[model samples]
Target chain A: MFQPSMQNIYRYFIISLLITVAVNFSAAQNKTAGSDKSSEVKWWNGFLVKMDVVSPVVTGFSDSEHFGMEGSVQFNLKRKIFPVYEIGFGGADKLSSNAIRFNTNGVFQRIGVDFGLLKQSNDKELINNMLTGGVRLGWSNFSYDLTNLSLSDDYWGGSQTLNFEGRSTTKTWYEIVVGIQVQVYKNLYMGWNIRNRHFFKEDTSGNIVPWYIPGYGKSGSSNTGFNYTIGYHF
Target chain B: MKRESGNNDYFNFKNLFNILKNFLHNNFIKSTVFIWITAVFFFSTSCIVSDEVCRKEKNSRLKVGFYTAILNSSTGNYTLSTLSIDSLTVNGVDSLGNIMDSVLYNNSKNLSSIKLPLNKFSNESKFIIRFNDSIQDTLTVFHTNYDQYLSFECGIIRNHLIDTVLITNHFVDSVKIQEHNVSTIDAEHLQIFHN
Candidate 1:
């Protein structure tokens, strides 16, 4: 009886120790590798550069567009504040139901700052993730082509078919963005953001409004946008 | 942790309420009320505005004026003089060789000018016009149809350009083409001269 009791205690002790070790190993691997780096890093740390892989992939499946690409670079400040710069190019060759043709290709840019919203505490587990809110100022300059447009004078005896080519304009807009980034691998992150964009002015001239704006989805006074990005940290 | 007190803070809810009360008591409320009023403004706009009340006829029709050719003694040329028909009737034909309805001006008396609509689907418009129940003429217009997109609200409109006008001469002597294009604007298109 004494020998059996001693074996049971020994077995229970080994099992508890193994369970503790396994739990600790997973927790450490899933969380940040080191907690000291997050607090010790001063402002003006290395930059985190990201590329938007979703935009190009989505444009490939777009019916109206030929292709599109977007990328961004952000500077980390105390791991709490970030200044971001984004650039993109998009174009579309679309034909309307009435045989009105619209073609355009343009470059767009956005500048913004993001604020980190993750709660900070001394005793919590170290997780390299962030919830961010940001505001952006965006602009695009482009030239477009409109063809096969017909105009007639009803009482007059003449009709004209007109084509407008290389009509250029500059558009300015603003966006409010919210997003989340999670560290998937060591020094690598995957993130997505939703943005609400509003344009300050619209081109409502005699000509038809542009069917598509470079960074904005459609040519409207307001729009919503989404981006999925993969990033690397230095 | 001690800074979370409710009464001693400038950013507290009480302070915000007081600030809003003060703002409402000032002229700033005028602009706010104006914005609210405009926010409630409603417009009955649509993608297509149906033809409702008949104010003025559509300008898509061709206008014709009747005239009599008089022998000029000085230039030895026939000049046009305005003439009115005793009784006039016009009918339009459709694609299935069916006589569509008689146009707006049917069995009219003493008409100086007549308006006729062209075919919307086909390139040719055929019309049978009778004058005084004794003289009848068939007018055929060959043209091209152009679909014009005015705007989203206005929708699409069909415009036509006349290539040629052929008519069977009964009591009519000659025909003159004044305008070759027909649209929503009103203008004289052709003049028919009587013998």
Candidate 2:
């Protein structure tokens, strides 16, 4: 009887230890969950810096080269999606008009979100993994200074000097970015994004014709591009 | 005797090959280092920094200059300096400098603008033209024959800040017409009377 009682007591002690660990883990998860609901920029433990090669396929410029680069910074709102701000720079437009060169080299700044859609299997016996997916919508305000740009009768064969300054305008655009970021290697993530831009409206305007956009060159409609990025979090 | 001599000859050839191999190996290593050094020197010298002045030709003329301000946004009324004149030239700016479309200034030529050097210029010191009515005007500026472009200097004095503008009136001309809309204000409108 003494031996049986002792065995039963030992089993109870082991079960109680297990319950304590489970409760502690659950409390920790709840604490993290509470924090995630507070801010759009605070879902993650740290931030991510991403670089992507961009190809803008604005409609008409299909046969031409419209390669570009985007640099973005994201702050997490939940385990997956985070608000992001991006700036882009690249070579000039591949197509130049009689007066405008496709020299599209400039800086583009953007603000949006990176949506994380895939959840990784937790290595720890206690943690359960979750997956999330979302989209980013924001406005893009960007423009190039035409003062440094020269418009010539040069393309169509005219030597007449063009006259226009202070004649330039500041243009605005809007974008919808959709991305899938997944957990891969210990806090190291990989994501792919495709963004669409609807660019129109000018703050000031004059005589010169606006340059064509990549993917939708001069179609003056919507434009789209894709990005592949690798990031690590702290 | 012939077979043994042939074998001896083969050994000699192998020795020669080994010597040449060692020589080639050392030479290639040296050559690679030399090429790398040459590349470093050539690439380092490629970029050269030089300086050029960015000032345009009109900056020298102190020409085609004027200071006007908006006093009443609702009325679209403005005021010009007492010595408001038209048409200056500079090798510095647009072919057609500043020109008013319909407003009237008594003297269009022999342009003698009042050279009032401003002592100070601040957001508060608004030297404005208080027009009695709304007028659409463009300040026509040009450089004088000896001038290139204009410069405006503003300074703060003891109590009054002054502004000075340099303009050249050698090449351009100014004509002010008071009517922005001919249907509302006709050509007879003028600013000929100022005390």
Expressed as tens digits, the lDDT of each residue in B94-125 for candidate 2 is 22332223222322443433221111112111
* Top lDDT model: 1
* Best-performing candidate as measured by DockQ: 1
Write one digit per residue (lDDT tens) for candidate 1, span A110-164: 9999876443323222345665667899999998887766555432234566677
For model 2, the stretches where C-alpha displacement exceeds 4 angstroms are: A1-43, A55-67, A95-102, A114-168, A200-209, A212-219, B1-195
Per-residue lDDT of model 2, residues A145-233, tens digit only: 23233212211122222222333333456655544454466766665654445655532322343443322223234444456667766
DockQ of each: 0.02, 0.01
C-alpha positional error of residue A230 in candidate 1 after TM-score superposition, expressed in Å: 0.5
For each candidate, report what fraction of the true interface contacts it reproduces: 0.00, 0.00
RMSD of each: 21.1, 29.6
Q: What DockQ number belongs to candidate 1?
A: 0.02
TM-score of chain A of each: 0.76, 0.53
